[model samples]
Target: MVNAHQTFVIVGGGLAGAKAAQALRAEGFTGRVILIGDEPAPPYERPALSKKFLLGKEERESLFVHEPAWYARHEVELHLGQSVTELDRAARTLTLSDGTRVHYDKLLLATGAEPHRLDIPGTGLAGVYHLRRLTHAELLRGVLATLGRENGRLLIAGAGWIGLEVAAAAREYGAEVTVVEAAPSPLHQVLGPELGEVFTDLHREHGVLFHFGARLTEITGQDGMVLAALTDDGDEHPAHAVLSAIGAAPRTALAQSAGLAVLPTQRGGGIRTDAALRTSDPGIWACGDVAAAEHPLYGTHLRVEHWANALHSGPAAARSMLGREVVYDRVPYFFSDQYDLGMEYSGHAPPGSYDQVICRGDVARRTFVAFWLKEGRVLAGMNVNVWDVVEDIQRLIRTGRPVDTAALADPGTDLASLAAPAD
Candidate 1:
């Protein structure tokens, strides 16, 4: 419980949870912080797990959140391998899997999500995999190890970032990879079709097979081994291993059990949260992939499952929990490096969100910067090779200032000159 000193119990020890704990300490919140995580080890980085680690390039220990001394130096009670089975909001306590009750005056729920598994007929068969945690990557790493010199066949179940990243890694490990997505284009709704085309070509160049607008129906096994996954598209193929990367649903069971109201989002997944990252119950907060935040810029509730969003939202929620009012309306940004392309995008430009599309370079040459323009204002910016455009566009979007959209489209115009001087 919280005496004059605040005792905070944070559930889930992924990027969000670790960032929350770090934020509390960074803000001089040195009362008593207990990070309750279900994983056996302390919090570690997750992004590189799919990239460098999966390719067998990164060492395992390099992923640790920080040196062991960092947690000790911050005075945070690091509870590793502990499962918080139930929440006792009435008593302001949590019952661990071991039956010990831990008390807290304030609680931060950063319970990151698990991958959405396919309901296909053979999904439960051996060699079917899910990628969301370090353990999941380790399993795939082991599978790739068993491949020897023979090219492995990998069928990735979704076209999201996780699926595509895993595909890149599989290709690096001498595997033939196929990406299947029900959506018409990869990250289409978020990045819009213009940029999605850029990615379509990129994957094609890498010799990655794409089955767009096709839904998987069954993952059938042969002799207890995962051999083929039939699709709604009437195609059946063999894959040595299948990775279900359909993304994650919000981990809201804890909030729901704690008697807090959980609202479903418009985007077909995740929990709804206010501007301050609080659920219906003020004492509890949610962030990371789980929280659907009301974005002031776009005038919509944006649920971003990106590394930058987690880094931003975690600290934003911690500041709110510490009684500081913070608005998290930054221009959303995410980047992925695949097959010699340093792809990056910031802000969102759904269809009709922008009236005009501005181009700064040639897409035919496979290098350019593009801007989404709405009423002479920069709505979003994407870069395939020229990334400096994002920095200027990010500033222009945050202020909602009028820009010279015509000049910016010419490829020679300097974007920074379009913004109004700061008052």
Candidate 2:
């Protein structure tokens, strides 16, 4: 039971931390809520940094999770551009970057993740960049504008979500783009080879070039500015700017330093937590990308780095902190928009875990729902350019019943009817 007078401290001012603060107030916890963030600005939606914001379709102020006045109204202490440098778990206290120590009754670590940087040379060049924060996006936007003015090329060193989305935005800005990936196809790890080819075809049709199975050996620079990238095959790709989007590593230094147990590298490196989002410490919890939490449905620990996970997990963690015997069982969900394609995926299935993928609707037309099945059971499903079937798809996965492949692939079949009957 949480006492109304106690203090709750949330570290990390990203989506997860902001939502947790909102959840505490919404759940009637009249406690002192303090949120500490390293970023100079308040919590903001990061997904827009690559899409709408990068393309100049959305304004800067619109990216904030809540207006500055909301914090004052809610009586939540908002600390921006201040980092929690040390965590003294035994004393239930945290040391801030400014040498101020604050105590808390309960703590939630939602440190999120950091973008991975390439180890190759020339990464420090002026025209090289990585996208993970608002500032990075802002800087890249300016760089893209310059590229557009000069009609220069943008070389992206990865074909994952961030890379592809930025590629789309760069192309929209009139900058020629080329994407290089180590995998045989883009998004092969998540969507598998067949569906991955769909994205390849889409980008190719839009005049975006791809170098599959290619390794970026070096980035060539002159006068501290990026000029080109050299691959393992001795192919030199020219570019006015380079963007590294090879993915991110979870920000777990705070949790680890506080003596919290973290998952091993092989198991997905993140702070280890139970289904309730409780860490090894009884009074501490974790959520969002920083937590590698055990999932009841998948019988494995998953650390999802997506917007939906942060939105749902924060509330789940907050409820658990209030002693609500809650289980954070929401199915892992994520969406990506690239070019004319909008895709929503639900459920969790490791690569190669599914035996088959059933497609409903036309793949060539790029309007369809693809279901991954293991022994006739739906492991995961993705709707591409198809809207309003996510709830039905999630229901089918939760039912855990065998599904008919022919009926699943039939466009005439109603998705709502596919859910298995309650036991």
Candidate 3:
């Protein structure tokens, strides 16, 4: 049982930390809650930074997880722009960057992740940028605005989700966009080659250029400003500005320094946690992108960086902190918006785990639902330009029963009926 007077210290003021604080209050915990974030801004949504926010379709104020007034009303202490430099877990204390010491009865590490930096030369050039925060997005937005319509050449590194989304935004803004990806196809690792081709076609139709299976040998710049990117194939792609859309690495220095058990780098670098979101230490917990939590459904540890996982895992972590018998078994789900395409995916199946992909609807028209099946069992499902079926897809995965491919592919077959016992 948690004492009402004990202070709860939450590190990392991202969406997870903010949601945990909200959950603490909602769960009737009256203790002092101190949320620490290194950034100057309050906790805000990050997904939009690469999409609507970057394109200026969403306002800055709309990004916040909760308004400033909400924090004040909830009595949650906001420690903005201060980073915890030293965490003495045994002493139950934290030393901030400004030499302030804070004591906590319970600690939650929501350190999230940092954008993976490219070690290639010329990355420090003036027009070279990476997006991970609101400020980064703001800067990119400014660069895009200054470039005007078809006046700027934008070179993007990596074909991951972030890189692809930013490419869409840059192209939409009329910038000449070129994406260089190390993989053979954009999103091939996640969506598989066939489905991945759908996005490749979408981008090509929008005038976005792609260089697949290419390596970025170097970024060339003049007068400390980006000018072009050199590829291993001895080709140079000229650009006025560049954005590194390569993925992110989990921020686990705090947990590592504090003597917590973290997953090996090969297994996915993150603080190791059980199904309840509890770290190796009894008094400490970790969630969001920083936690590699075991999932009952998959029987494996997964560290998901999507928005939905952070939104749900934070609250579940808080409940577990209060000694509740909670299991963080929620199905992992993520969505992306690029060009005229909107896709939602649920479930976790490692690459090569699924034997076949069963599709419903029309793939040529780019309106369809694709299921990753292993031995006739649905391992995961993705809906593209399709609506009102995510719940059914998740249900099919949760049930863990072999599904009839014929029924699954039949457009007339109701999704809910697919979950029924095999006849």
**By descending lDDT, how would the candidates be arranged?**
2, 3, 1
Better of 1 and 2 by TM-score: 2
Look at candidate 2 and give me any clashing residue pairs: none
Supply the global lDDT for candidate 1: 0.80
Instruction: Give lDDT tens digits, candidate 3, residues 228-339.
Output: 9998888899999988888888999999998999998887789999999999999999999999999999998889998999999999999998989989998899999999
Global Cα RMSD, each model: 2.4, 1.6, 1.7
- The residue ranges of model 3 lying beyond 4 angstroms of the native Cα positions read 1-4, 421-423
lDDT of 1 at 290: 77
User: Candidate 1, residues 149-212: lDDT per residue as tens digits?
Assistant: 4777888888888888888778777788888888888877766676777777788888889999
Stretch of 10 with least lDDT, candidate 2? 1-10
- Write one digit per residue (lDDT tens) for candidate 2, span 289-405: 999999999888899999999998998999999999989889999999998999999998767899998999999999999999999999999999999999999999999999888
